[model samples]
Target chain A: MQPAHSNTVIEASKLGLTFQTSDGPVRALSDVDLSIGKGEFVSFIGPSGCGKTTFLRVIADLERPTSGSISINGMSPQQAREARAYGYVFQAAALFPWRTIENNVALPLEIMGISRDERKARIKRTLDLVNLSGFEKKYPWQLSGGMQQRASIARALAFDADLLLMDEPFGALDEIVRDHLNEQLLKLWGQTNKTICFVTHSIPEAVYLSTRIVVMSPRPGRVTDVIESTLPRERPLDIRESPEFLAIAARVRDGLRAGHSYDD
Target chain B: MDRFRDKIIPVTTLLAGLVVLWYVFAVIMNAPVQRDMDRRAGEDPRFSEFIGKTLAQAKPTLPAPHQVATNFFENTFTRKITSNRSLVYHAWVTLSSTLLGFAFGTVLGILIAVGIVHFIALDRSLMPWIIASQTIPILAIAPMVVVVFAAIGVTGLLPKALISTYLSFFPVAVGMVKGLRSPEILYLDLMHTYNASASQTFWKLRVPASVPYLFASMKVAVAASLVGAIVAELPTGAVAGIGAKLLAGAYYSQTIDIWSALVAGSVVAVLLVTLVGVAGRIVERSMGGRPA
Candidate 1:
C-alpha cells in the first residue's frame, strides 16, 4: 500500500449493478463499498458471478452502477474514462490479430492521438516493462499464451495511467507461467507505482499480490470481508509457503466459504 | 510424384470417367437423327460405320466431347480476333462488363454493410430490401435494367454493368454485414474501455475483421457478375458478346457455336473465381495467413 499521506484513487459506496435479461433481473453487484489508495495493489477474490469483473468494468466505465455512487480520483467513472485516467487489461489478451506486439501496445496511444515519436517511445517502454521487448515485431498468435497476456499488460501500461484495472489477466496461463507473471507483475507494480485493482478467482494469487483482499460472494453479489496483508513490502515466491502468508490466505478462503452458499 | 498421385490422379480419373460416359450418351441421343439421315441416302452400313455416324451427327442432341473440344479450339484460336466470329472478342466484351459491375457491386456492398453495421435505421430499412432484391429473377431484372437505362440515354457498358452489380452485390453485403459484426463482445468492450470513437472502432476493428469475409463473398460475387454480364447481353441483341453469340447460334440452330460459347464462359468463370481465390491467399499471407 502507498503511504497514508496518499489520496484515494478509487472510492465506492453502496455501488450496485443489475443486468436486465429476458429471464429476469440479475444483480451482478450490490452494495460494494471499497476505497483503494494510490500505489496500492488490491484484489477482488470471489467465485463466479460475484461481480468481481463487473466492479472492475464499472470502474473502467464499461458498466454503470445502478445505485449509490463511485468515483475515480475526484471525477465520476465516465469522466475518468473519458479523461483516460486508467488502463484496463481484460481476461483475454484481446490483441488485434493484424497488429504486431508493439502496435497492439500502441493502440490506446493511437486512440488518444499521441504523436508517432511519442507512441514509439511509449510502446518500447511498456513492452520493456512487461519483459516483452524482443517480441515487439511478432504477432499475438506467434507468442505463447503467457506472453500474449504479458503483451496485453504492456498494452494497458502503455499510456502510463495512474490506475490499472485488470480482470483475470493471467487466468488462462498455466501455473508455472502464472507464478512467473505474478512475480513479474509485482515487480512492474513496484516500478510503476500505479494503483492496481485486480479481479481473480485464485486464492493464492489474491493473497500473494494484494495489499488488501476483497472477498465477495454471489446470490446478491456483495462484499463479505476485506483482509489487509501483513507481509513485508519486499516478498519472494517462497513467501507463499510461510506461516504468515498461509494464515492470511486461510482467512481469505474462510471469508469466501462463509459467504458462499454451496448447496444452492 | 506424391502430389501427382495424391491430387492429380483422382481428378484425372474422374474426368476420364466423365468423358467416356459423355461419349456413350452422345451415341444414344444422336441415333434416331442419324438413322433418318442414313435412310434418306439409302445407305446400308456396317455396325462400326453406323456407330461412327451416330456419334458424328451434324446436329446431335448432345454434342460429343471431342466435337465440343474441336469447336472450342476452332472458335478460340482459328478465327481472326477482330472478326465478330472471334470467341476472344466476345469473351472480352463479356469480361469487361463483368469486371466493371463487380467493382461497382463490391464498393456498393461494403458501403451498405457499413451503413447497416453503423446505423440502426439502415439495418432495419435496407437489409431486408437488399435480401429481397436477390429473390426477384435476375432474368426478369436484366431486361428491365437495360430498358430503364436506355430510356434515360445511359447506354452501353453502364446499363449492362448495373445488371452485373445487381446480381453480385447481395453476397458481398450479407457477408460483410456478418463480418463487420464478427468481433466478439470482449474486443468491443476493450474499445469501450479505451473510449475510442465510432470511426476509430470501424477502421481499427471492423474493417480488418471483415476482410476474410469480404474475399469469400467476392468469389461468389465475381461469378454472379459474369452471369449478369451475359444475361444483360441477351436482351440487348448486341452481336458482339458471348451472350449475343449464344442467342444467334440458337436462332440459326448452330449447336456447335452454342456449346463453344458455353465452354468459353465456364473457362472464364473458373479463371475469375480462381483469380479471387489467389488474391485472398496473397492477402492471407500478407496478414500472416490467419486473417482474424
Candidate 2:
C-alpha cells in the first residue's frame, strides 16, 4: 500500500453514504478508503446502482456523505467546489440547445467573470484541443451526437481546472467513435497532466485509460478491488491486443464478476 | 403547389363554407318578418320577389351577408378615420388601450414569475393568487374596475387599459413560471458547480430561456387585452371603440352596425396576434433557437 503522501489530490477515510427513499434507506456507498495522487488518471468501474457515479458526485459536492469523511485539495468537498476545484462531464452531453458551441464553452468563463479577451482565447484553445474549432458557431442540435459530446467536453475543459470528474463521458458513443475519443482523451491527459477521476461500466475502458482502476460492487456499493496498471504510458489503439493489456483487462473483468452476485 | 393544396385549399374552403352558411341563416331568419310586411301591404308576392325582399329587408332580424359586408366596407374605408361612425376610428380607440395594457401586463407577469421562481414564499403564496385572479369572471370584474377608477378621478384610456392589464397578466405569469423553470437539472447543476450567484444564474440562463414563453403568453395576452378594452367601453359608457358601437347598435336595433363593429374587432385581434408571433420568431432565432 502507498503511504498517504503530501501530493495526494484526494483523500477519503472510510467514506459512506445512505440515501433515504420511500422504500427505505438505501446505502449508496460504504467504507470507501482511497487516496488519489495529483496528475493521475483513475477509473471507477461498477455495474448499475454500484455508486460509482454517486462517488463522483460526492467528490463534486453534488451529494454529501452520511458517514466518514472525504476531502479534495485539503478542503471539504463544498469548499473545493466553491473554489472551482473541478469540472464534471455528465453521462449525456447536457449542452444548452440554444447556445452555439463557442457560447456553450464560454458559459463557465463568463460565470467566473473572466474578461472578454481571456474568454475568447480560452474558448479558442479548448475547442482546438477538442478538435471542434471549425464548428464553433453551430448550435448543439445542429451537430452530430459525437460532435455535441465533444463540444460538451470542450466546455468542461475551457476553465482548465486541475481536477476533471467525468461520469461515463463516452459511454453513449459507438465503439469506433468511443475509441477515437479515448485516444484523444489520453493525449489530452498527457498534455495537461490533470488528475482525472473517471467513472465507467466498461472493463476495457477502465483498464485502458486509468493508472489505477477501482472495481466496485452493488448492494451497499463497496469497493471490491483496486488494481494498479503495469502497461506503458505511451500506448496505441491496438495495444488492447497486447498480452499485458489483456492481462489487466481480464483481472478487471474477474473483479466485476466477483462483485456482481446474482442472488436477490 | 403542395403548400397551396395542403394549407390554402382547406382554409379558403372553410371560409367559403361559413359565408354560405351565414347567407342561408339570414334568409331563414328574415322570412317571417318579410311575410308580415307582405300581409300589411296586401301584396301577395311570387317566390323570387319574396326571396329578394327577405334578403334585402329594411330592418331584417338577421342581416344578409352582403348587407353586413357593404356596411363594414363603407364604414371602414369610405368614412374618414376621424369620423365617429367609421369602424376604423373605433378600432383605433380599442387598439391603443390593448397595446398599452399588454405592455404593462407583460412586464408585471415576468416580474411575478421571477419572484415566484426565486423566492419560496412567492412560489407558495403568490402563485395560487395569480391563478385565482383568472377565475373571477372578467365581465363581473370589469364594472368594478371602472367604478373604482372613476371614483379616483381616473377615467378614459387609463381605466380601460387597467382592465386590459388585469385580463392579460394571468397567462404571461403562468407561461413564464413554466418557462423560467424549464432548464434541465443537469444545466442547473452546471451552474451550481460554477458557484454562480442567484442573480448571475438568472441573467445568463433564466432570462434568455423565458423569452419564447414570454412571446407565446403575449400573443394570448394581446387578444385578452383587446377584450378587456372592449368590455371596459361597455360599462364605462365610452362613446368610442367597438364596444360602444355594439352598445349603440343594440339600443337602436341597428344589427348591421353591430356586425360591422364585430368584423373590425376581429381584424384588430388577428393583426395583434400576428405581430406578437413575428416578434417571437425574431427573438428566438436571435437567441439560437432552431425553427420548429
TM-score of each: 0.97, 0.98
List, residue by residue over A58-173, the lDDT tens digit for candidate 1.
99998888998888887899999989999999889999998889889988999999999999999989888989989988988999999999999999888889999999999988
How far residue B156's Cα lies from its native spot in candidate 2, in Å, is: 0.7
DockQ of 1: 0.72
User: How many clashing residue pairs appear in each of the predictions shown?
Assistant: 0, 0
The weakest ten consecutive residues by lDDT in model 2 chain A span A1-10
Can you list the residue pairs that collide in candidate 1? none
Chain A: TM-score in each model: 0.97, 0.97
Off by over 4 Å in 1: A1-6
Q: What is the lDDT, from 0 to 100, of the residue A24 in candidate 1?
A: 100
Kindly list the per-residue Cα lDDT of model 2 for residues A1-264, writing each as its tens digit: 234477998998899999999999999999999899999899999899999999999999999999998989888999999999999999899888778999999999998999999999999999989899899899998998888888988888889899999999999999889889999999999988999999998888888899999999989999999999998788798999999999999999999899999877
Per-model C-alpha lDDT, please? 0.91, 0.91
Candidate 2 runs further than 4 Å off: A1-4
